[model samples]
Structures are given as structure tokens and as C-alpha cells.
Target: MTAHLITGAGSGIGAAVSARLAERGDELWLLARDAGRARELENRFPVARTIVGDLAAPDKLSWALSHQELPDRLDSLLHIAGVVELGEVGELTPKAWNLQLAANLVAPAELTRLMLPGLRAARGQVIFVNSGAGLHAGAQWAAYAASKHGLKALADALRLEEHDNGVRVTSVYPGRTATPMQVKVHQQEGKEYDASRWIDPESVATTILAALDLPRDAEITDVSVRPGR
Candidate 1:
């Protein structure tokens, strides 16, 4: 079975993707923010293993994972955990910018750097669950968009750097998905959130699975998923 490490497995799209992979009997390594969260993930995914590493503290991921037992070879590394706060450039604080950057951009880069050996050994793939903000920064989305934009750059650069190593990279941009994150975004925007108006997490999970199961001859470098309704 394929072995994959996933961040943000606690909820939203990450939870959907992990559940689907587990259904197919794939091995999963779920990254959690702490020991308490790790135990929760262990309970949620009884057959999967948990890695305790706080994405909010990107500088410490190396130390956190070094002490854990990682898979010998990884088929995929899914970077899906993200934190966002909607604030205009004039009001967003440095701490707010740092929080989003650390979790959404720097953490993925660091985690990927630490896992390159395993990914290279298996000729694996890396999937970044980006956002529509990655492509366009709207009003009150400066900091969040900046982090996602950096994530897009990271994915693009990694794809080129690792192509010769037989590793593929994909970026999935889901537009206003009906996840808890969206709810928070709506709250930040002072708007009511309606779940039916956005894309489904399972739908995005299916899109991600398609990229993972694609033919070796072709690669899905980037995909945009929008709500049909």
C-alpha cells in the first residue's frame, strides 16, 4: 500500500482525503499540533499513525519529526493544513502575517525539505491544497493571499527541482470550500456562511485522488476547483 504523510488531517479537506486514502488501505502519517491532537487523530484514524509537530512553529518541525519514526519510503506528502485571517494591509499586524506565513508556507517548505529523502526513494508526489487567494488577492486578504501566493511559488519551484528525481508536484486551488475555514473566513468578513453555496470537501478530495492516481505519463501540475452552483 502507498504511504503518505498529511498535514491538516484534523478536519476539512485533509480529513476527507485521509479518510478516502484509508478506505483504500493506504498507510497514513497524520501531523498534529500536539500530543493531545495526535491522540485525537489516532482515535479518528485507528489504522493510521500520528506525528506531533506544530505547523505554527515551522522552525521546530525538523526537531519534532527527527525523534519520530517515519516511513522508509513515502508515496505522497500532502500539505493541506492552513490558517488564515482576513485583514487589510493597513490593519494586519506583523504577528498575523507571521502566523499565516509560518503555517501555510514555511511549514510546507520545511516539512518537504525534511521528507525529500523518503519522497525521492519512492518517486513520490507532493500536493499543496492552496486557495483562490493564491491566484488573486482581494480586499482584506493581503496576508492570507501573500502566504498562499508563496505556497504556489514553492510548489512550482519544487516541481522543477524534483522533476529529474521522478517526483511530481500538484497544487489544488479550491474556491470557497464549505469547510470550517470558510466559516471562519465568512465571520471575519462579517458575512453569514451558507454551506450549500460552496464546493464540497469530498469533491475536492476526489479531485486530489485523481491527481494521485493519474497515469505516470502525465502530471496534473495545477487544478482549480470551483463551486458548480
Candidate 2:
């Protein structure tokens, strides 16, 4: 069975991807912020394993993972967990910027650095679940957009850096997927939530799986998922 580690497997796109992979008998390793969350993930994915590493504290991820056992070789590392807080340039505080940057950008980079051995061993793939904001920043989305943009840069650099090692990197940019994150974004925008109008989480999952399942002879670098309706 191919083994993979996933962050943010609790809900939304992360949950959707986990469910799909689990159904196919893939060995899963889920990341949780704490022991309680690890328990929750274990319950959710009965056959999978769990690791406790708080993305909020990116600087401490090395220390935390040092105490735990990680996979010797991983087929993939999915960077799916992220936090978002919307505010304009003048209104967004340092706390908000740091929160988004730490979780979405710094944490992923640190985790990737720590997992390079396994990734290199298996010639793994790194998938970043980015947002459309990563490509284009609009009004009042400064901090979140900036973090995502940085994530894009990270992916780009990693793809080239790891090319000779046979590790692939892909960034999937989804447009307004109907997940809890979308609901929160709507709440922040002070708009009514309607799940029907946006792209489905499963759609994004399918996109991710396609990238993962591509033939070794070719690799997909970037994918953009937009709402069809």
C-alpha cells in the first residue's frame, strides 16, 4: 500500500481527500494539532495513524515531531491544513498576518524540510491546496492572499530543487469550494451561505487525485479549479 501523510484531514477538502484515499486502501498518516485532535483523527480514520504537530507554532514543529515516529518512506505529503482571516492592509494587524503566515506557509515549509528524507526515499509528491487568492489578491484579503502567494513560491522552488530526486510538486488552486472554510469566508464577507452555488469539495479532491495518479513519465505542475456553475 502507498503511504501518505496529510495535514488538515479533519474537514473540508482535506477530509474529502482522506476519505477517498482510505477507500482505496492507502496507508494514511494524519496530522493533528494536539492529542485530542489526534484521537479525533484516529476515530475518523480507523485504519490510519496520527501525529501531533501544531501548525500554529511552526517554529516548534521540529521539536514536537522529534518526540514522535515518522514514516521511513512516504509516497506523498499533502499540505492541506490552513487558516484564514480577512482584513484590509490598514486594518490587518501583525497578529493576523503572523497567524496566517505561520500556519499556511512556515509550517508547511518546516514539515517538508523534516520529511525530505522520506520524500526523497520514495520520490514523493508534495501537493499544496492553495486558493485562488494565491494567484490574485483582492481587497480585504491581504494577509491570507500573501501567505498563499508565498506558498506558491515555496512549491515552485521545491519542484525544481527536488527534480533530480524524482520528487514532484503541484499546487492546486481551487475557486470558492463549498467547504467549512468557504462558509467562514462568507461569514467574514457578511454574506449569506449557499453551498449549491460553489464548487464541490469532491471536485477538488478529484483534481488532486489526478495529479497524484499521473504516470511517472509526466507530471502536472499546477492545476486551477474554478466553479462550473
Per-model TM-score on C-alpha atoms: 0.99, 0.99
Q: Return the lDDT, model 2, position 137.
A: 99
Worst 10 residues of 1 by lDDT: 84-93
Distance from true location, Cα of 199 in model 1, Å: 0.5
- Misplaced by over 4 Å in model 2 are none
Candidate 1 residues 127-152, lDDT tens each? Answer: 99999999999999999999999999
- Provide the RMSD of all predictions against the true structure, rounded to 1 decimal: 0.5, 0.5
| Deviating ranges (above 4 Å) for candidate 1 | none
Query: CA lDDT of 216 in candidate 1?
Result: 88
Error of 2 at 227 (Å): 0.4
Candidate 2 lDDT, 62-146, residue by residue in tens? 9999999899999999999999999889999999999999999999999999999999999999999999999999999999999
